[model samples]
Target chain A: MAALQSIKQNCKKVMCIGRNYADHVKELNNQRPKQPFFFLKPPSSILLPDEGPVLRPAGVNMHFEVELGLVIGKQVKDIKAEKDEDALQYIDSYLLTIDMTGRNVQEEAKKRGLPWSIAKGYDTFCPIAGPIAKSKITDMHNVEIYLKVNGETKQEDNTELMLFRIPRQLSDISQVMTLEPGDVVLTGTPKGVGPVTSGDVMEAGMRINGKEVEEAHIKVE
Target chain B: MAALQSIKQNCKKVMCIGRNYADHVKELNNQRPKQPFFFLKPPSSILLPDEGPVLRPAGVNMHFEVELGLVIGKQVKDIKAEKDEDALQYIDSYLLTIDMTGRNVQEEAKKRGLPWSIAKGYDTFCPIAGPIAKSKITDMHNVEIYLKVNGETKQEDNTELMLFRIPRQLSDISQVMTLEPGDVVLTGTPKGVGPVTSGDVMEAGMRINGKEVEEAHIKVE
Candidate 1:
């Protein structure tokens, strides 16, 4: 698959999910939110897609979350559920994402009910996998997230268990706003989330149709 | 004062506040939210620390939101309200922020419970003004936001009227995610919001102690 135009070589917005899964929310002591919460990470936060080393942040407790990332090929917005075909009009494209979290920071942010920008929006916080064709995937609604730290499985989940499904979120998010080309979406992360530290090599990848959409190894800097 | 190290020259995140003001909430037909609603604008959304026109994307209905911005000086987490003063121990400085919005996208995202990165995070969407001292500002709790478009006054409010307040938000946001230097906190816009079109010019600035901190002019692109 060719690289999506916007993310091919332009600025990308890393749109990510928070508390989209019930158990993850419970683990964090957060009540299931009425709405699916989202946050942003700067494009620079990304590791070059398909590259390795996971690039962990040193001196602090950091965690890993592997997610099914969807990159819009074209701008998508205000999509009606009935406009499934029309909704495709707004998809920028598809991609993979590693929504790394500062668990310590996340806990504090949730407690304050403050916007999680400061805690989540770091230069290397949002990492991408590849530009996959949305049509190539059979089940956009159901997908698995696999994360391993130093060859140990830490987090693994599927999209079906998400508190809010993708199409619904796409329509809901787009209605109030526009989803542009190269804009990435973090569908959500599953259970078994854990922490990583410096010198700890971690690999996270997502497989769809027996292909890896995301493959990354994080190393502490 | 010498420029504080707070402004990360390469800022990755622009965290924002929505309906932070009571009257502003009323203007939007919203009751004051129990929690302070926030969103993310990518670094591409930023203009500069000084005055400049926030570029308006073609064909979208965009609006102006005058806000105060803070530049965190260090990596901080678990900042509690009581320890906010300690949180200040890490902040390098603050600036004034103009949170430009794509009204349509924001509302749509809010309704669908999707993230607002797009509506808020477009290139050059976040305009900053007045570089001030982190140690200089007497109170992040109560600063003033004065805004105008094409020479017409649009919004005027004091941070004192904010429901969540600064230290509280700082503590809360820092706890959820780590805040690094140059990451900004846009305290949210006040009321009297409206749209601007191509060829419309926006001029905004802020003041502390009767001195201008920073200001900028934005023209639709």
Candidate 2:
């Protein structure tokens, strides 16, 4: 109920979901996953608010993916979603975050059957906004998320477009790794994901029921 | 340094090196990587000392890959390892750990270009022993590591076989994700990796200069 800020410190692991949106999957020419495709970015990759510019590493094609972040408030494991709904209880709050990725490096790793750590685990790779209390978000399933780079809108979509929604994502992940208090899960990004260059000012936010609730601003350097 | 016995509580992330040994690369039919191949396992996956049996999930071909774990003692980033040295200062201690893997799950994920989170990150997957102080380890690069399933040797090798040794591993990793105190690096596994079934007892240990230092026992259930 208090201001659950200090995301950079409270967070442990950043669990990420990929290919959860149809259009986004098509844009990347990836098969629509029958199950949730998961990966992780280290907490060291987090860049807190006012932490300064996000470094665009040399020879890297950095891409921006804005998504809803679920902050786990309790320790839960083996949560089952057996045609009923009990998975939402694990989520303490929500936030807006950018799952910054090094596209070129990621492609190479994928082709070689290697891990995607370096591609997504660089310092300043993950940037976040408000820990909008669970009480504030009326319906997380229908919330709107969008991203803008250099004053131009690039990605704009609603959570309704997500292939594997929040409850399923949380339930599935909990079956493998225990979700602890402060662990954050980045629900997959939506369509219109694109690249960001140095000196680019990127802005992203979340809106629930037409009310702007959370926002994040990051500059590339 | 005091006894850093509570590994599960103290650790934040487990950075694992893949394809770091010539024989291991050849055994897995993987090409030698020009650069370090990295991935991560969540802290929740850790099974501490005296913790019960390591659960082998149903339908999963759980395999054991014994490795030397390096515990980072200092916060380091962008560490440069030239022809000389200096990377060893970051390591606070060492340990023996089994990087339990779901071979079938991993193979499916790899073939599909998916992240190996679930394949390699199930609960009770990482079983470790000893935070042998850095002072006790005369030479981390030359120590021997071995593993036995049901009292039969499966993997036995020296750290000297690692294609990318410690200093290089720490330096290269720091360049991407800042290595914080208590963070661990599982310097890849060796050859002779094989599947472990239920009712199997795994005994693994480390030897420095032919003297036993750390040993871990895990029972499969």
What does candidate 1's lDDT look like per residue over B110-202, in tens digits? Answer: 564445666776656776654676655677665666877778888867777887777777776664455656677887777888887666767
TM of chain B, each: 0.86, 0.94
TM-score of chain A of 2: 0.94
Stretches of candidate 2 exceeding 4 Å from the true structure: A1-5, A82-85, A214-221, B2-5, B82-85, B214-221
Backbone N/Cα/C clashes per model: 50, 0
Best by DockQ, which number?
Answer: 2
Candidate 1 ranges beyond 4 A from true positions: A1-39, A42-221, B1-8, B49-52, B209-221
What lDDT is obtained when candidate 2 is compared to the true structure? 0.83
Error of 2 at A79 (Å): 0.8
